[model samples]
Target: MHKFIVHGGRPLSGTIKPKGSKNEALQVMCATLLTEAIVTINNIPDITDVHSVMQLLTLLGVQIVPLGKGSYQFCAAHLHTDVTLTEIFRQEYAKVRGSIMLLAPLLVRFKSVSVPKPGGDRIGRRGVHAHFEGLERLGVTFCYNVDEEAWKAKCTTLSGSYILMPEPSVTGTANIVMAASMAKGKTIIYPAACEPHVQQLCHMLVAMGATITGIGSNILTIEGVAHLSGTVHTILPDMLEIGSFIGLAAATKSTLTITDVPINLFTPVWSCFRKLGIRLEEDDNSLHIPFQPSYHIQKEIDGNLLSLSDAVWPGIPADLISIAIITAVHAHGHILIHQKMFESRLFFVDHLIEMGARLILCDPHRVHVVGLGNAYRLRGTRMSSNDIRAGITLLIAALAAEGTSTIANIHQIDRGYEQIDQRLNALGASIERA
Candidate 1:
């Protein structure tokens, strides 16, 4: 167990670049199993989830060579193992949801994949039915043994068709895309998740000789290919991290210049932030978050209070809803945060309430936060992290609070943010990880 001991009431001032996207790197790595050629991925995030994916790949007989820090060359060309070492990696994989992606590639190439129940944030019921349902559209059969707590899916040749996902689940969409890329004929996916990470995986597949249209749209067209060769691709910057930093700067009144932000990748995200009174500046390859006025929630067109809710890609991300909630606490007016994607994600607000936040928990999926408007600073207090995003949001609140605060169970934070304590320390934040 690790903890972050933070001396609060300090405004972090300096520039910091976010690490690569963890979500993107996981999908890219899983996509490698679809091909026999060497795939080189750059800008990989040095996070626990990624390392677990790498471990899973190695267990499947793929050779992963380190090109440098945050870079790797993966070759599954000679992979011979059919048995997924799920038992060895089960505990680790249980820490991140992206581990479920292994099923598609394994089922495609080897005909069978056995995996333990995938684990991630305990936010809500994340069903694998989307993945199974989508893959079944391509001729895959699934069997689950409840007593063993494992699932096995097998398929011969996948026949492509139209797949309408129950929800725009990001990992589910990636699994389907990977499976469809190698199936016979063409496959169409409707109501797909078009997040930047999903887009990057689609582009990487295309670079490896897979045909995929509708790069940034809800409808995706993937034409099956006989074979795919390895190619070099760079993972996109972590937009979630970028958004978190934006919130951090606003909460602490700091100016931060983030480089290589992939500005176009974040138009919708920035627009959502603007609705909350957080303004951002963009350049060709960078984004600047300057000190702004005290934040406030915008009113609705009908002159009623509006709530900030998360949806699929193009809409606000559900993962950032917690950070948005914390940002709203420091803003001027009250706003509702509807975490439609998850049930328990809003439970972390109780910690904020302890720090003197004016919040009303409407339900498991919604909360209303009324900002203190710079009139009151959150008082420091001991807390525990319940999930990744909430953990980071608590850290942010701790940094903005008065006096000292201790956060336990920091491994939850390490699973997502790489060297978060060190990175924040570099930005003049008084935090120690022990």
Candidate 2:
């Protein structure tokens, strides 16, 4: 029932720091189950999804003590294996997508797990077949328990084997990496997701005494070890959050600096934004997005319309497509937006089209946008946030719109972005959480 009351057309100023990567934090949180020692993680985002993962850990008897803001200590020393025996655990486990990550780690430690089908964003059908298929190669067997709506998984033992990933899925890659870390033999994985978050997970696992090679590349060679000890790990700053801020500053024509950004992890993002002619300055660890009255979309070398598509790690992230669509509203030119990852992701463009953006819906996966430049400002309207990415996109559109706007079901936004309204309001933007 929560909603965000936003006043449009407010110029924003000041520096904003992005939170830790939600994807990395979630993956690393699940990785903690790999060892029995105390594992301390820093720079964890205080968002709903992170909190949900923490709850799942606690239900499994992991001792959680808050060290400081965005820092916590986790010890699985007293962890119990019969977690699904509790009704509360099953109920809570079924509510978060992150619960799927628990399977690989628990299977490595206890060799048996009863995990319910996970719930998460309804953007599209995100199946766990890859995760299980890869784990099954490690000597795991799965049975679906229709009565409990859960999957009963048991592993006699783990044996590392060559796993050519069906696709470069982030969670699937992470799950396989974790299971292979403790397997008995050598595991070779190719076409693995090499996204920054996935790399961070591999790096963290390595620090915990696992032998992993090719940390940044898609192909990873893992030598299974007998034991893994706990270690302290810090997550990278949220790249999705950084991209959202860039889109917001561009749409609002504001000069804002996002501090302490990992510019090295954002090659594709920078390329796409530059293609829109949005000027950005980079320091060693920070990024400066200057205020520009207008910008243009740069076409191809042969003067064709610019095309932005989401692909594997080296390509533009699909998560930013919605925000890019909003940024394109203020830039002058035509571009094709292809959201090939999820069939239903581009459907949220209807709300922006209603707000006066000159966009054509080519299909469920593509949108042709004719950037109106600064000639038109989107008029405020009431809308519902259907997913995390769509919610942030609406917030950006509302902030740069002409009047007052209402965004309902803001819980979707809270699942990923931490204190987004308060943070933006701190920079002189008006956002009321009602």
Candidate 3:
């Protein structure tokens, strides 16, 4: 029910650090269920989705202690053996797709676990076939219970084998990898997701005595271990959050510096934004975007329009597509924003068009943004956020608009970004939480 009243037409200048990866935190937190010893994780993001994952773990009998800000200790010494998940979990699972990750770790431990259909942003169809397929290869069987609308899964004798992921899905990769960690033989995952967060999970598992190789590439090999011990792991800075801040600086015409950046993971992002003539300076551990009144979209040397699309990795992340579109609204020249991964992701552009940006919604998956540079300004109005990325993208558009704007249903945003209004407010952006 929370809302953000954003006052527009102001530059946000200051330095901020991106929080720990929300996606990484969810995966690693679930990975904690794979061990009985104490596992301490640093840089846990204080966001709703993470809190939901933590709550799910606690409900499943994981002992969690707050070490301090952005840190926690977990010990899954015992878990409930009942077929039924906690009522609160069933009720809340729809809001947290991360809950689906509990399937593998729980299946490996309890031999059986039941969970309702997972939910998250309504971006598009996110199928669990990949999860069931990869785990099923390792001796897991799943049955759908019609009355409960849940999947009942059991793994009697876990054994590792080669798995070619149906897709490079981050969650699916983590789930199968965790299950494979306890499998009885060598497991080879070809075309695994090699995002920094996925690498973080594999590295964490290795540190905990799981044998893993190919840490940062599409192919990964794991030797099944007897058991995994607890280990301390620090999550990489959230690349999505880092990209959002960069887009904010470009939209608001501010010289902003983002510290604690995992710059190596953002090569494609740098190239994508630099195509818009936005200056992004990188160091060993931070990113800086200098103020620029206007930037032009670099077309193909042969005079073709620039196309920005989402790919698996070393490509512009799909999560950043929303912010990139809004940033493109304020730039010069025209570019095609393609959301090939999710049909619903680009639907939020209607609000930008309502705010006076020139854009063509070619279809559910494609948009053409005619960047007017400084010659144009969006006029803000009331809008409701439908998802995390779209919510933050709307906030950024409002900040660069000509008048105040109200964003409703900001809880979707709260689920992802931690204290975003407060953080952007610190950078001189006028965002009031109500």
Candidate 4:
């Protein structure tokens, strides 16, 4: 029940390092189920979702030891349970979308798995039919009564085949890859998501003895292996966090150096920020954000100002659309933001509007932000978080606004960002956790 009370209008000027990617950590942790050897993972984010996944792994009899801060050694060699404690694991697993990633590894090891409907942002109808269909092509059988809320899946052995995903759902593709890793034959996945997180998961699996080709493309070829031996791997920096930091620095006129950014992983994101008139400098593996003279929105091809729109992977990510909306408010031009992935993501714009932002909510998925420019300062106001991205976006707005702002339901923010208040405080942000 903690909240963040932030005094706004402060320029954050310092060095900040982002934690491990939450998306990669969750899937990589679940991928441990495929191996019996010790796997060492570094740069793990200390977030609630990661804790929940660890709890689920512990319940399944996997041995996990915290070697040091942000480092963990996991060995699933002694995994002794085929049936998860349903009552205990259900609620925790449903709290985040990454929970669905457990299905693939579970199916490979135990040949049976039952997971409750995963919970995530209420953006739209995120169907698991793709996962089931992909698994079904590999000889998995699903049996459950939807009305009774009981679901189970079992497969004697999986034989790989071609799986053409209807959409490039990131988690769904990861699930299929995990399932295919230990199958009896080769599996080809088409139109798969090539997001950096997904590529990281695939590379980790390959490092752990899985044979996966196609590291950064839509089509993936996975060769089945009988067993996997664990290996030491380092998780990549959080790109979503990097994007959030970029928005925060620009909104607050801060100069920040984000270390270990994995610049190659965020090429599309970097391009998107450039279009917003935010300057960035990339070193070997870090990104430097200098204090900008002004943030301005680029014009459209039709000679009219256009909004930033979110699409699938390789385009702007849907998770950062909210952050972009807040960034638009501090820019020097008019821009529209269209959230095509989730219908409800744009609903949080009202909270920013209360802070004196000139924004028009065109619909559930569209917003028009007319920048207040440097002439006006947004006034801080109290806000409650509705989702992970929105929560951080509100915090960014609060940091850039005048006066003090209190953000409640910070647990939503904690689910993704690791020690966010502490990290921002280190960067000269006057934020305190209450």
- Candidate 2 is scored at a TM of 0.98
The reply for model 1, stretches above 4 Å from the true place, is 80-82
Model 4 stretches astray by more than 4 angstroms: none
lDDT digits (tens) for residues 1-434 of candidate 2: 99999999998999999999999999999999899998999999999989888999998999999999999999988788787668888888876787788889999888998988887788887889889888988899999989988899999999999997888888899999999999999998888999999999999999999999998899999999998998999999988999999999999999999997988878888887898889999999989999999999999999989998888888888898998899998899999988998888888889998999999989899999999888888999999987899999999999999999999999999999999999999999999999
Error of 1 at 302 (Å): 3.1
- Candidate number with greatest lDDT: 2
Query: All candidates' lDDT scores?
Result: 0.87, 0.91, 0.89, 0.88
Worst 10-residue stretch by lDDT in candidate 3?
80-89
Alpha-carbon error at 334 in model 3, in Å? 0.6
Candidate 1: residue 214 lDDT (0-100) = 95
Better of 2 and 3 by lDDT: 2
* Deviating ranges (above 4 Å) for candidate 2: none
Candidate 1 residue 161 C-alpha distance from true site, Å:
1.2
lDDT of 4 by residue, 1-434 (tens): 99999999989898888889999999899988888899999999999989989988888888999999899999888765554646777778778888888888888878777778887766666889888899899998988768646468889999989998988889889999998988988999999999988999999989888999997899999999988898998998999999999999999998999998778778888888887889999999889999986878888878787768877778999888888888888988888888887777778888898999998999898898889679788999999987899999999999999999999999999999988998898888899899
Q: Total backbone clashes of model 1?
A: 0
- Each model's TM-score? 0.97, 0.98, 0.98, 0.97
Q: Residue 27 of candidate 2: its Cα lDDT?
A: 96
Please list all clashing residue pairs in model 3, or write none if there are none.
none
